[model samples]
Target: MTQKAKSRQEIAEEFGISAKTLSRWILKEKLQIPQGLISPKDQELIYEKFGKAISK
Candidate 1:
């Protein structure tokens, strides 16, 4: 038996944030939180689109 990968909501819960907030960060490329929480691919995608983080 093997465990399935967690969903976005599950990931957000682990980080103590809401799924919507997580989506916002990912979609808008605003990663203002701590490191090691986000995947490298996501980081690269965000950086590629937004250049840098623009916190709100």
Candidate 2:
């Protein structure tokens, strides 16, 4: 499956987190956001970490 790249706003909404928090995660290296934009691999990793919480 080809996953689409998502913007910071999209990721924040899908993860149920604030964009500011997402940005902080990126800055802190808690989340590995790729240079320029968020890639599919990055999205998958983020989902693997937070998907369950957001799904509930």
Candidate 3:
């Protein structure tokens, strides 16, 4: 089966934050990111910590 993927923008949108902020968090190890997209392993962890962002 193919793995699912989510862009930085989508992940940020889910946390109500900017992509830049998410990038910084990844750099600082504040967020769990493997690369350009959020890995499936970290998806649940992210939502557990930050919940969902209000999409416009």
Question: Please, what are the lDDT tens digits per residue for candidate 1 over residues 1-56?
Answer: 11343355665565567878767866575555444445545544544554543322
Global lDDT scores for all candidate models: 0.53, 0.69, 0.69
Shift in Å, residue 25, candidate 3: 3.5
Could you tell me which 10 consecutive residues in candidate 3 have the lowest summed lDDT? 47-56
Q: What is the TM-score of each candidate against the true structure?
A: 0.44, 0.63, 0.58
Clashing pairs in 2: none
Local accuracy of candidate 3 as per-residue lDDT tens digits, 1-56: 11577788887876778988877866675764577666766766665666645545
lDDT for position 2 in model 1:
14
- Tell me how many clashing residue pairs each candidate has: 0, 0, 0
Model 1 segments more than 4 A misplaced: 1-4, 30-56
**Residue 11, model 3: Cα distance from true site in angstroms:** 1.4
Mark the regions of model 3 whose C-alpha exceeds 4 Å error after superposition: 1-3, 27-29, 54-56
**Candidate 2, position 48, lDDT:** 73
Model 2: CA > 4 A from native: 26-29, 52-56
Shift of residue 40 alpha carbon in model 2, Å: 0.7
Give the candidates in order of TM-score, highest first.
2, 3, 1
